[model samples]
Target: MPLKGSDSDDGGNDDLARLLSGKHAGKHRRRSRDADDDVNGFPRLRSPRPRDEEEPATPTSRRFQHRRRRGFVLCLRTPTAVVLSSAALWILFYALSLEGGDLVSIVARLGILGAYLFLSIALFVLAVLVAVFAKGIPRKTRGGLLAGLAGTCVALLIYDHDESLYHHGGYNALIFALVVMPSLAVGAAEIAIWKWLGARRAAMCHLFALFVAIFVVSARLSRAAAIWGRGFGGETMQPLARTCKPTKIGLPWVDLLPAGAQNFWAGGLTCAPAAKPFSAEIDADGALRVKCPSNDATYIPLPVTREWPQDWKLVEENYEGKLPQPFNKRVMDAIRRTEPFRIRGDNAPGMLVPRTAEAAIVTCDGVEKLVLRARRSNDTSSRTLRPPEQMTGSRQTKTLDVIVVFLDATSRRHFHRRLGRTVKKLEQANADGRTRLFQFFRYSISGFSTGPNSRAMFTGTSPNNLDTVSPVWEDFARARFVTAITADTCQDWGASYNPRPAFHFDHEMYAPFCHADFFAEDSNPLGNFRGPYAINARCLKGSRVSDLALQYAGSVSSAYPDRNTFVLAWLLEGHEGTGEVLADLDDGLVSLLGSLDWSKTALVIAADHGLHMGLNFAFTRNGAVEHRNPMLAFALPPWLADSEGRGETLKANAHKMVSGLDVYATLRGLGKVVDPTGFDDPDVRKRAQGGKNLMEEIVPPDRLCSDAGVPQWYCECY
Candidate 1:
């Protein structure tokens, strides 16, 4: 009831209420009252306006404004949160981009997924911390902190510019910019959000951070699912429905023989001709035109060649009239047992005839020459003679200078679709008359890593034993051939598993860097500047494996133009992350082939192993077969390609079951080197115990994985 200070108290409460509500609240209340005119079907009376249009400031509103300003100052002062958040974001970015780690086992591969999840969680915690600690910092301090962070980011960018992380004109630059810009923007936005939300800023920041973390984790999980799921379902090995059938071996002349001559050789002629007087000559059409005034004369077509006498034979004993009897007998016997021969009229008496000839004649000065020609079992009484059955020598040589190029980690699946241009170019070259010098074969059962496959190829044996392996290069070296092996990675050359001394190469050119160098420095992080992935990028920009191969090839061609050369150019561009360098590899191959004389060189373009990227749908979806399916091709010299239907043989056998061991056998065949394995029987070799020449009969369709020397763990052939 004491009314002494009631008026003062009332006035103070009114001022505090006005201050708490602010002028905007009064305006809102006035607007609400104006909208209630029709509430009782009568206009609501309005209060008279005060002298001042602005409402008086309230204590509550003023206190809130001061508190918001204080919160902004606090956020600006705490710079640690900003630094930690930015670092976390960068770490996440790097973790996602990491490459070159060997995920040999399933567990190791799944660990990568776990690592990504852990990183996302860590990023979320850092973001929430930033929101919580960034309340009430001063503006000047926040500015200073932001400026320092920006400077640090710039320094990092500069330091990574020359490194692999900053790939000019590549996706790396875009990725780097994406990571840096967003992170800096997020830091700046945190300060602004803090000032605006005041007490509610921390809660809102937590929600936003949660959303970002979930987004990143979901993205990573989805990618992991796609990659991991591909290898999860389906049978690991599927049986091939098609069966291998052996192709029959036939005489080369079958394609060239005339219909009438074929029929005559079949059974039209009768006994061998007796000694008689006759004349023999070759017509303009390269047919043997015989004139026997004493008997019926016949003509037989023959292949056109200037070296006639060497491939001819004498038929009659008395035809050696002017020569010694013993010499004539010896010559006749030799001719009967060997390749088709051409007779030199000056050396002996008889006229030139095919070594198959049972009888032949010559009239040097128009007088009848006593000679006899052999005949088939048929009794036509025709003077035409059949060549001896024992004459089986090839006119063209089978040997050639070999060039084996091993492209690293190139899967047949990748090359099958992507290398269309190269394949077309090769096919065109094969059809060209000038370049008819080469033939090609595509192998399908080519897979596995370089270590096992390469060893099989070079040593002509199974990869099961490394100690007893004998490099085919040794044979080439022994034959005075220039043997060269060029590689950028030590893993394929001088590493622990692959000793340098075991491999015999007249010239060895090793690249200064390899995958081993990536893990060489302990201070470097997984995908950092000094890692193998980064070094690979750097190595790609400089003199790469392809460059070394080109240099080695050029040197060999220049130094030993006449001597046969065997080059094993192992290029590394097809390995993971080095795919961008594949074009260079292709260019190097083109240059190498163009620089060499293909007439003498037999080129083999193959891969030591298939792509190990773990993304190939064929291998991943079916069962890890992609790891085993490498690319194999051959470009044989014209002499070998055209001889004994060899080009046809290679084409026919391309689809037959074969592996790197078969390649080894083919190499040995080309070089005429005997296998040290002591298994020389063609039938035994066809069983696939170790090596078998691809040019021979078809590899038996029933040949098992065990017979092929493939371990069960890696074998997919069922």
Candidate 2:
């Protein structure tokens, strides 16, 4: 059908092609303006040509013809305009690249970018002026106008992406968005002038513009891709020093490497004495408890009634995979009997949560695996729940949201291997100078296995029989924290490792269900992977238990946005195998790490130990090194890092020999916990007994494995 204003050319079924050539517009420009026909301030459009044959010369026919003319509308998009816009953009990008891509430089180049940004205001006023004063356009013509602009945008973006691959290092985001985009608008306006002359000439002009675009984009894209890809490559997190003790005899580069490999020095540090910022120790017989809040008030109400959260299925649904949007009845019906538990947790899992879920054991489909719904309903964190009234605010010098994740049997190298997605994203954020996570290059494990090592971090000592102590959580509780919660699939921790009364957390979640299911603590290592706790082949139901815990934590954050939360999660996915299976968690891990509210949050991600059970990984030389040295990383508040060179401080500390006990000290500092009795580690004028607070102090440069609390058998200080 012909467009209302261009009856001659719009009759063709090549509207998109016509739009590219700037036809189907202004065909009736020869006609005089008629104010009565105008809609709002826009001039009403009419066909430049009359009908081939007149309808009956009656008033009724004439009225019908006018209505038909008013209905047709079209976008006046043009390809020639796109070509001109491309030219102007190249100059802008070149200027931006020269100016260091900084804020001040950008403002200077944009002319109207200073404080008042008068240019932007003027543009806004100009648009308003056109909408208010311009005549001869119907209200629907505005949609057509937007379409014309949108068409130009689509063409530009397509050309740029295929040619530049901006993020793939073709052009930095700054130059691409700013210098190149607006040029298209300028080009589009230029072509509108040509269409005023006639459609035939404009269509002919599009051919020349097309040939030029093809030639220019082809000439530049290849060289730009090669240069930028090298300059702005993807980031890579190193698993270990490039040349470990036994592998130091070769060249650094492997020639062909993994995608996004840029950091040549991330693995530069050797097992040599390396560098130590500072270190000290205090004489102490046992680990010191976390300091309570300044007020030292307890917030636990008398009736501490407990129940599963209402939004458990929200997380359960995510675990089952991203549901299609719009959740139509058809979509809902398709997923009715499957995962996601749309109606209720128990309904979806087909199992009822036990009243005293702490001790109840259950199975999934007769196997020792749990349904995702079961995890949310039974195993998720509880003490972390804070009442709305308590969620008011904190009165501390600083209130940092703390997240502690204990990854079982994952080494620093293994972490880089399995959770590469999370690692790369955090690194990219770090590169952009945003809030991000960082890993310590020399975080040595203080204990042999998951339980003892983490216990040393949590309680400040890894004792065999002395399983009880003033747990670190008490300090958070006494501080009147809004919420403090821990979640684990098994009831007791350290059972597979230490073999004691199930090491109790403040609350046990999802343990009974795991027990009733096909829960086998490494004894039934069915597949190749093996350490212990490989329940139902490393899954609760069909989802990885790690993902369940991760999603649960995300849901908790979503469920309680206003409250301060302390989340402690134990991930057992890597414990039972070569841990290669952990690769599956890359996407989930990426989401969890990036989802945090980092402004006030403090994140700690550490592994208790590396590969231990698998003979292949455990017995190898590098494997042994990885086993002894676990990963410890922290994501502190962005402001703290920005002030006092603290980011640099963390980097320096990362290279120092540290262990879980030191982590205990750091936790005490972060919580701003004060021992109620005003006790300090004993200062004997000798070595410091307690672990060093990483923020306030550091482990001694020449610190030995024994000094840091690593037992002789597990020590690999070399």
Q: Give lDDT: candidate 2, residue 419.
A: 70
C-alpha RMSD by candidate, in order = 25.7, 25.2
RMSD to native, candidate 2: 25.2
Model 1 scores a C-alpha lDDT of 0.46
> Which digits, one per residue and each the tens of the lDDT, describe model 2 over residues 596-617?
7777677788788876643324
